[model samples]
Target: MSDTAHEDPELIQLLTPEGELREHPDYPLDLSHEEMRGLYRDLVLVRRIDTEAVALQRVGELGLWASLLGQEAAQVGSGRALRSNDMAFPSYRDHGVAWCRGVDHKALLALYRGVTNGGWDPAEHGFHLYTIVIGTQALHATGYAMGIQRDGAVGEDGSAVITYFGDGATSQGDTNEAFNYAAVNNAPVVFFCQNNQWAISEPLERQSRVPIYRRAAGFGFPGVRLDGNDVFASLAVTRSALQHAREGQGPTLIEAFTYRMGAHTTNDDPTRYRVSAELEEWRLKDPIARLHAFLTREGIADEAFLKGVEAEAEELGESVRRDCRELPEPDPLDIFHEVYAEPHVHIDRQRAEFADYLASFEDAGAEGGR
Candidate 1:
């Protein structure tokens, strides 16, 4: 671990809950007024996206949704820290990072709506499709980073890969294996762990005794923990980490200490496992609220602009609702479409068999009508 990482032993905070700004000497920041407001906009808009998706799930428009509530700053901060060339591998809940990668909200919704296997081309956007499996993206990212290294893409002009997983996923074998692999290979990857305190009812205490980031040290790299609710800290630390990776410094582990602030998914009830008091406490460190407070306190955003953001959020909500409804139901056969990049004889035979099986249903319906 970097010696300076211990400077803020408890937590790395650049923005207080009260909206006051704090700075770390190791991480200097100079954001334009517009840039700061833009960060706030990203936070608000992604939160709105999360809200709309949850509502869609409730209405049965979506099969399921993994909410990114209360972790907007962490996602936005790290996401925006990436250069366009940097690749991101996200877990199912990283809608905010997807938004930063310029993925269309409609496309993201398509997956939840069960309309598309994946909404966007990853290569085009430099963002991989959401990985539903817990910690598999870690291995995927590490492999990609090693590929980038083999291709001589590990310098200032090169690219870095970041993979996100929750605290619960840290216990997974794949995630730990990725950590060890990246360390040994000096892969240009960042293992971003959003320790939202619960892996579906299992608290952080139940997961690990040492801080998640500190585990990077054992693997032979630096790990840093930051106030995940503080957008400034998230951005600054991630940006620096990415730079380190690009410069051929080995992998870094970033533990964003945050809260889930909602159910594990539309299907799970957070109330069943946690108390209201815990929720209320994290609410005080709400990511969007802190950024808003900073903007208002620093006079970077005015009443009109703030109101405009709210109006925009409402507009976004409406658009998501309308467009999601308009999406065409995907063909069941589409699943066989991308099973492979090239068709093999076996896949072709299987597809034909499946098509015949599907057609039999139509034949039965015709016979019934007769």
Candidate 2:
């Protein structure tokens, strides 16, 4: 209904775009000086990771890249709110969440570089692989949450599940089905939707008449609309939502009202569907800039500390660029390596046939050159 998230009355914001700090009664957060500085560091570092990935895609090193440029605060805040056992199912653009879960940045580069399907162990980090088929992760998270309940992990301090999706994905059948299942079964899941104002070329107004958060009421769950650009609000609200789910209160939907400052993916051209004026407007609410402003204004981070973070980002970017090029070339037949936990005759035969087919290519190349 409003031009920006800031203008929405229901949107919870603890940090203003102009860098002033505020308080919300429902979602109170008391971060220490060190923690405040850490959040700023988290925002800066994730943006650097995005910048390097974008550059790699442009130079032909990556197959494609989905940037989380303006949505850093939402991802980092929600990610940090989770407990160690809590699981996260992220869409492709959720690199910031992966970082918070201790995933190596080089691992992300390897995935986009086509060297690996995914570079981290989901079980180890409690963070799933980047889901390319949109909205499917919602169902996966719901199932996992149901399993958590079966395991008797539905009490105080219990583990919960959080799944990320975009505004457009709210229209998908799979996501809606998951919501129904989670609500009916009282599964421990938090459906985190980053309503970044656009789903590729389509605007939010075209997808749903009401805000995305209100859709939760129809699914028999509570919903919240928060300023996604404010890290403090994101962290506090998500913490409460996950706690509600863990206590067997069922599903909760959190709509992070933010903007996508970059193209949907490396192959996309935002300029074709959007205009420069809109981009300029959202730039004022940039997550990293707002947090940095707060940290500096409050004197929580000194010049030396800021420079240290910048140097670390530069070092990380250089490492990503170098290691990305060094990632081993994937073997085409490697796809057949882990088809099953145990061997099966059909798999064996299929592997052999595929190998023979690949050999035929080598023979054809030699003969053709001769």
Candidate 3:
């Protein structure tokens, strides 16, 4: 091996691009057949919904969509690793993870549809609303983890939180601060970074000279890198990280090596910045296809089962489209409803005035009819 190769950072990969499963000494899942199928089901449905969301954006029903097309395994595996009581801080592109947290398909459309910031309550689903500002959610996730520690929620079956961010976010000050805080305080949180090769048009090399996983050492924590396209690897690595945090071992950094096969959002024209050759290269490593091949080849799944899964995926796509289209646009009055815990006189007066203004329009229409 070359000296440079030896100097390269360590990556903890347990599954290969060729669909072969490798064993990891530290991280192993005692997954039942049903649990394995359930994980696959989540991946299938999440992708279907993602496709429908993109279509909705094209049809003008949505203002924009942050596509999760190529990062399904990374999101789903990490999301499923969390316990029911654990919290998640997600960025705008985490619809796949949101699905694993039991968030409804319709609930995610509010932000993209320009109806609300976030329609669902974060506390209800144990997942925070989609944070648009890059790296902000990391700090929030870290702070929440600190709160969990204060509340004595970090021992003997206590929950641990996971926060999702992208490669570009690693350069942000807030993200660095989050790491410092989590590491210093021994906060029970997992920082899951999906290193999907690009931060929009910017390539991964432009972000840092050293591999991102190495940053954890500087923060006084352990970090691991896994093949994000390999669901089994991602699942195992994330489960281990979360388990470590829950056991009071402090924060862990998981860098999932994947590729972004789609534009950053519907508004982006990635073709302008990226070459087709690179996209084609990653296409061969498609996460879902690798898993399907592994299952079929191992005799754990067959053509009939695969066909059934396809049918179910199609049904899920149709249902998501139907429900997304049927979603009621938020009432305009909702703007004033949840801004503050206690009502202020000034806000109450402004709300009343706004209602009066709308009433005046109605009254004018009545007079015109008369």
Measured against the true structure, the TM-scores of the candidates, in listed sequence, are: 0.96, 0.96, 0.94
Model 1 stretches astray by more than 4 angstroms:
1-8
What is the per-residue lDDT of model 1 for residues 27-68, given as tens digits with 9 covering 90 to 100?
877788998999999999999999999999999999999999
Which pairs clash inside model 3? Answer: none
- Give lDDT per model, in order: 0.91, 0.91, 0.85
Candidate no. 3 TM-score: 0.94
Q: What does candidate 2's lDDT look like per residue over 1-370, in tens digits?
A: 3458678888899999988898888888978989888888898889989999999999999999999989999999999898999999999999989989999988898888888855789999999999989899999999999999999987887899999999999999999999999999999999999998889999888999898999999999999999999999999999999999998899999999999999999899999989899999889998888888888898888999999999999998898888878889988888887668799899999989999999999999999999
Task: Encode model 3's per-residue lDDT on 38-63: one tens digit a residue.
Answer: 77777888999899999999998898
Better of 2 and 3 by TM-score: 2
Q: Return the clash pairs for model 1, or none.
A: none
The worst-scoring run of ten residues by lDDT in candidate 1 lies at 1-10
In angstroms, how far off is 364's CA in candidate 1? Answer: 2.1
RMSD of each: 2.9, 1.7, 2.6
lDDT-based ranking, best first?
2, 1, 3
Name the TM-score of candidate 2: 0.96
